[model samples]
Target: MTSTSGARSHTSPWELYDGLTALVPRGVTVTTCVVSRWALVETDAGGAGLSSVPDDGRDDPHGPQDVVGQDLADVAALVRSWDRRLAAIGLASINAWCNTQERLEAHAGDVIDWDASAFERSGELVQGRRVAVVGRFRHLDQLASRCDLTVLERRPQGRDLPDAAAEFVLPEVDHAFITSMTLANKTLPRLLELSGGARTTLVGPSTPLAPEAFAGRVDEISGSLVYDAPWCRRALMQGQGMASMRGALTLFNLRVPA
Candidate 1:
């Protein structure tokens, strides 16, 4: 499901965090939490947030101090933490908070064209175009065969370019699918600036999904919604990630019209 009907807000990438922070309501507290390979948070209001935990050699998150039962605002503030895991947790908190408030009914697929997977419906738009994908999505061969593609990963894999390549590559691409990890890593604003005139989509489970937070930087927002917060929290506790989310998630996209 998707909608361009999202109410708009800040236009500068610098104000993105401010816009996201505002989506989180006051007084709601996280009632259940898991910090593993993926960070998951379920709020008292029944909203759930899930995010990829950055594997930066950090042995632990919060060192058993406990994240659950904390006021969400305190957790959300950690989105700016230099510690990557804390940032991931903070982002999940923000997403969880927004899930409780955003009107998904207005953004249903009947009102806007959103695929179960962004790459699912990409052949027509990217075939023959210069495509740049950030974070190396799992089902990437689909995109690889359809376009002149370049992938940027912070941890370079076979044929993948490190993010340093963005300065030199993004400016020349026709389209860019950037991972929302850039938000956790504090590089999203810069990535947006480097994408130049390329059409940019902010994608992945970590996406905050607040259209106004990305109004000027992204052309589309593709993120996941967890149907059963408890199930997802259990999966996270078991150290599972998106591969195990078959029945729990519904991926969707929101187009920001030019």
Candidate 2:
């Protein structure tokens, strides 16, 4: 088990944000945007993307509710905001723009498997190798037998390392399965650097499936594309968690071409 020696970016969010902002259509007003316990947005074309926003957003005073009718390009720019609530909404917009709104960007030579989970795919490749899953995703138990596995979380639970341990742990791993929330928290750039040459997959529903945005930054993109926007929006508004997304979402993996 070994980690790669350089970083994809010491400065992140911008390089990634720049790529996504360029992809989102200009002047297209978003149809729906909400941030209660979860942040979600839908493009005018029925595309939906979701983010886990823990804050109730009731007291933020300044929020992105006005983003519904705003230019998406300007909305996408919010991903760079330092305010956590604003950043959460911004990420939701980017996910909606990149994954759902721009589904036509099937880059040539890129292969997307619609029925696979990132956990399963990552497990297949980590046999007897060192792996670090930066989020506390379920099913790590299934992977423990095949690899030297480690789990890190912002709120450490069980044996998982604290998120800060990435500086020490990521540089020594072979594969890093990073959570998409790293983008919202603006920790992704540094995490990528720590993972260096290690094969990496940006894993979560919050991930923007923009290959161009992540070219050379990651090896694979594993995320969900919401097929039923209304259903997801309703669910998010009704306080449903990710586990309750009954058939409204489809998980996919896009293997970035080398």
Candidate 3:
């Protein structure tokens, strides 16, 4: 159910999107669509996409107004859409798109449930080593004091380096963790290329659990799997952030095979 075998066929993340869209069940109805702090869609079968972000009027032709009431199966296909910002719909599709992987995780064979320690596990690989983080995650204090860490953020804050620093820092780092939001913003491929020398991990909510998307580019995928659909839906509708909805999600890690 993990699709690691099929992963070899997908050379890019967009190709993986096409593969996942093909798996979305026909006749599935989208019961609710909410766009506030996060874009979310709920299907009749308790499926919910956790990372969908609504397109604010700018470059996106299809906004939340265009997606509400549409069938879940149709919206799920937006993962392959041309408008990169339509990723709000595409990210939501992860719930419907990876039904098989979710089912497999539910049975508890290969998936590692990290609960609150997923970040800790990610840091373990970089302990006492030179590390570069693509995004400025809030838990930097948890890393080992001896570790050499350089943070790169799109919008530089405090001591964190700007995104431009990636060219100079990534190749020299021993480990790197790139935010999975790169998938939605369409930056994963270039980031992977830049961080080729480091042990790279894709981290965050928008990360598709699909191994096919990561394949040889990412060494690990640190992401959350929605466990309580109602809680997740309510959080999205109320504009409450993921940091406040810990009970609704289970953190999981997938190691891409060598």
Best by TM-score: 2
- List model 1 lDDT by residue over 1-258, tens digit each: 122222233356547777788778788888987888788888888788887777663444446247888999888877777677888888889888764324455555422344367777777789899999988788889888999999999898999999799999987888889988788778887777777578777888887767756666678888877777777877777878778765787676777544
Task: Tell me how far the alpha carbon of residue 41 in candidate 2 is from the true structure, in angstroms, after superposition.
Answer: 0.7
lDDT of 3 by residue, 58-146 (tens): 34544444665677778877655545545666667665445334553653544554554446775555668888888878888777364
Candidate 2 on 59-96: residue-level lDDT in tens?
Answer: 34555547877777788778777666677778888888
TM-score ranking from best candidate downward: 2, 1, 3
Q: On TM-score, who's better, 1 or 3?
A: 1
Candidate 2: where are CA atoms >4 Å away? 1-13, 54-65, 101-105
**For residue 228, what is the lDDT in candidate 1?**
79
**Model 1 residue-pair collision total:** 0
* TM-score head-to-head 2 vs 3, winner: 2
**C-alpha positional error of residue 205 in candidate 3 after TM-score superposition, expressed in Å:** 1.6
Cα-based lDDT for every prediction: 0.76, 0.76, 0.66
RMSD of each: 4.0, 2.8, 4.4
Question: Which residue runs of candidate 3 sit more than 4 Å off their true CA positions?
Answer: 1-13, 19-25, 52-62, 80-85, 99-101, 104-113
Task: After superposing candidate 1 on the true structure, give the runs of residues whose Cα lies further than 4 Å from its correct spot.
Answer: 1-14, 57-65, 100-102, 109-115
Residue 214 error for model 2, in Å?
0.5
**Pairs with backbone N, CA or C atoms under 3 Å apart (clashes), candidate 2:** none
